[model samples]
Target chain A: MQAQLIALDWGTSSLRAYKLGPAGAVLEQRSLACGIMHLPIEPRDIAGIYCTNGFELAFDTACGDWLDAQPGLPVIACGMVGSAQGWSEAAYRNTPVDVASLGQALHCVRSLRGVDVHIVPGVIEQVGLPNVMRGEETQVVGVLQGLGTQVLIGLPGSHSKWVEVIEGRITHFDTFMTGELFAVLSKHSILGRTQQPCDQFQAEAFDRGVQVALSKDGQRGVLSTLFSARTLGLTAELSPDQQPDYLSGLLIGHELAGLPDHARHKPIILVGAAPLCARYQRALALCGFAHVSLAQEATERGLWQLAVAAGLTQPVTEA
Target chain B: MQAQLIALDWGTSSLRAYKLGPAGAVLEQRSLACGIMHLPIEPRDIAGIYCTNGFELAFDTACGDWLDAQPGLPVIACGMVGSAQGWSEAAYRNTPVDVASLGQALHCVRSLRGVDVHIVPGVIEQVGLPNVMRGEETQVVGVLQGLGTQVLIGLPGSHSKWVEVIEGRITHFDTFMTGELFAVLSKHSILGRTQQPCDQFQAEAFDRGVQVALSKDGQRGVLSTLFSARTLGLTAELSPDQQPDYLSGLLIGHELAGLPDHARHKPIILVGAAPLCARYQRALALCGFAHVSLAQEATERGLWQLAVAAGLTQPVTEA
Candidate 1:
């Protein structure tokens, strides 16, 4: 079973390349820390002259670099790697976007190595204050394909996205810096100074954080609620190892609390790494959302759908 | 006139010394970046043997180091310099506390050099979850003295405090990590990567941030609203240079928005460095608070009042 297409999820810190079979199943995948930002050459000059360890390289050389043991397949790339600062600037597609429309808006860059390359355009909400998502849109599209209904979807990661999918189109969405905030606060803030590293998640401490966030009745919200992580430690109610899980719960709880009223009552399709999805699942349950389902291979599925829709790959028959 | 007493505001990052006249007026003042953390001696051995640049030192050496020309005067110190890891562990005074009670709670350490030294006890709210304030209590006391009535006081800094005073007593208060959040985010987060050095505050950008925070209608609060700083930049709604002020406005706006509903309707007495207070004043006005007053010499005045209340200094008549 030879690889039929390459699906790339290129972000700031890492690059994931999935080799998809004819049936759109992930045949094999490779990941490297050499993200867009790690490239030796500037994004503008990446398409032209560039060399890595005495080898001449083009901007699209990532596909070649990762396919050392296999032949190069047609590539479909998403995430920040397609931004203005990426290999080729793929203009953002405005909202009310669907998988088909996103496929139509794909930015095809001429590959120097004769392999076809297409970059998915990110989605932008242009009404009022603008909000944009690059890599998450792909996963959202993937979830849309699987769910195929009006569903509230949450893609949680460094930057979590909550989208309202209505009739297979993204009607509205919001991006929360919850993961980033948790990272920054835990690593840099006073509340994080005493945090001891732990391998296991402390559900008790996490639940305490969720309870506090949910029970908040005063005008004091996240800003003040955050201080409790420190106070709880100082008062001996929380231990050093418990701080991380508690902080995670607090942040996730706050994010869940902020969800639009309509999204809160309904079941949410959560898409992301298992650990983060599980944390969100717990927080969602605590926030009164009864049903929270997880979707696997969201990025791969979405990229595959976009590839088929864009005529870059053939539709795979079901088993 | 001879210096009657020394008032010290010793914090995590810096130490300030004010030489007060008989009436508690600041006759002369000095500051150094050598805060408690910078001291070479351990908190336990601070009262014993220590040396700075080959000279013998003690727990009260900070006052001695700064008072090279004048005779050593009795000192009143406040802030984190009195924490468990500070010069001496001053106990926290649980609140619903009055300035008189806090003054009475001052921990006077017997100086080896025979100089009288009193460290003002910090206030702790231990009813539900423990919340503590060190240096701000002094300033709140000062504001209470000046206002002599019920008032909502905001002490803005690394940790901003919103306090309620009735009959010259601190009835309740809340702490916001706004400034610290701004510092960590701007210096460490992705939104801060494009920030450039600028001396002047960008009012237009700041107002935009405040407006966005105020206009937030969905479940997305600060976590979501913060992304606008990045999105607005990507979409060209905000520039990199304007990010600092805009972030300030956003955090300040969120802090103001989180204030107890009753506090928002009343005028707030803001006490802090001029620049921070001015920014808060602007944010408060934008958030619909009609009256905002600035309290000058808050820390010094508060320290003086504590000294008099503790009977550590002679009460002098105001000119």
Candidate 2:
């Protein structure tokens, strides 16, 4: 039987873990609604456990029982589990780390039940730019392993990250809180309640916001752009759906405004959710990034690769 | 006993009305906790009579009989009262309007019986720089009279306003949603609830934030600056109280970064709550602004001044 390797991607709103075979294929995938952000700080409180559909307990019980059933198996973890409030802050290893070097002993420790556990070290790009990354380090490695060339990877989400890979090593990176800005703007700014959830195209307002973002004078600061959405709506000019897109344009525009000097002509690969990934692809294309493409579920795939590097899974060719 | 004109400044959370004598003196002042935002859409639902302890019930009963006494008023209104939910919106007279020429005639028709109502026109400066103002226009005029200035003025609040006054004439103005950014950054950003409220000077984390804001690089989009506050607190060895202030500094710094050039050299006047006002005052001084000072309840006094201008009160000699 193939040995078991556990790979997890713990996000703010969801938890996803995959049990991998020795050949690195997913034997079974499990997820729970319990994210670290929702957990009560008081360890005694089981509120997250109760609200979650038996996933956390089941994960622990099943993994523990499986380990008992078969001794000498090791499980490795990554993602928000390594954040300060997570399992523990996975001390960052400064970048330019080789995939072979990532073999350095994973954050190995014993669980409450005395089960041997290994947590991956989140990468910190402190040399050129002061940025921290957890699961994406594995994703960059995976992309590098698959691509076999220097690449510009755009990891989009609450905090969209961009990393530079040269010769299978992550040279440098920066974290832009793009996705986070969209969340606050949509949920708390004056335009918060007005952002209707939809995938429909808000071509018009987005164009306007993009124009503003592209302007030399307008891109100075984006906080002012939010008020325009309210005023435009009040004046019967902007539609409800357009509000989110307009805000998206403003944020993406600001992000683009600060793009690294080398990024203008670089090959852009997006790694995140579908709509957002698509939006970044389009925004970059508008900014003359013609080689833009999507990197699907790179975070999860990244964690799995880290598992392999941690000696939890056997290396297999990317499908 | 010349007929006194009562000036009301009713908004989302507070209701304040002023009793103006034939000679513009604050003969009496009354305030209530109920604001229009707290009331439901139905007019009848807002008709009940309620008064605070200090208010005379008999006098309230008479006023109640006059205008239903719940949310009672001397009657001229400004602020949110012009929104779709507040009193119906009064159309604006576009820019360069004389404080005397705001020509913001109230929607007298929206009042209940015996409530002779006039809701001021919310100013709209749509042409060049594009800005709209509702309640602040009246206050600007009042402060102008109070200070006897035909100079540039600033009003810092949820929306920081910059009004251009040339010889008692408001040439043009613009609005910046600065306070809203602070609220969103503190409550909704990834740093959500991480930076809790603390006394202004008592916290060192706040000073760190201010330093970050003053930093050349930290002056970029505030979203990026916000994450640093948590990072600094966790890694840089800062006290808890200072975290919130650092957040305030980043937000205020972002506001100052985008402030108009013309207003920077002018005598800057502030009109708002103390702490927020004080924060803006601090921001102005730090930004190399030469002259900055605060004005007392300028909006209320501005409304009172409007009453005098409308022949509702006789002008008093300069005190």
**Candidate closest to the true structure, highest TM-score:** 1
Tens digit per residue, CA lDDT, model 1, A101-220: 788788887664455578999999988778888988898878776464778999998889998888878878888899999999988999889888699989999988887777753236
Q: Report how large a share of the reference interface contacts model 1 reproduces.
A: 0.70
Model 1 Cα lDDT, one tens digit per residue, B258-308: 887788666679998998899988888887898789999989988998888
DockQ of each: 0.67, 0.34
- Give residue A182's lDDT in candidate 2 (0 to 100): 78
Q: Which residue window of length 10 is worst by lDDT in model 1 chain A?
A: A50-59
Task: Calculate model 2's interface RMSD in Å.
Answer: 2.8
Chain B TM-scores, listed for every candidate in order, come to 0.90, 0.81
Query: What is the DockQ (computed on Cα atoms) for candidate 1?
Result: 0.67
> For candidate 2, lDDT tens digit of each residue in B1-319?
3335667676666667666554556666677664665543222222344433221231232234334423433456677766665646677767778777653454563433335567777788776335678788888877786554556777877788778888777787766777777777767766655555664564344445555665755645665666676555555454556666667766777767776776666777888789778777776677788888788867667776676666544567443
Tens digits of per-residue lDDT, candidate 2, A187-220, equal: 7766776566657878666767766666754654
- Chain B TM-score (model 1 vs. true structure): 0.90
Task: Let me know the TM-score candidate 1 reaches against the reference structure.
Answer: 0.93
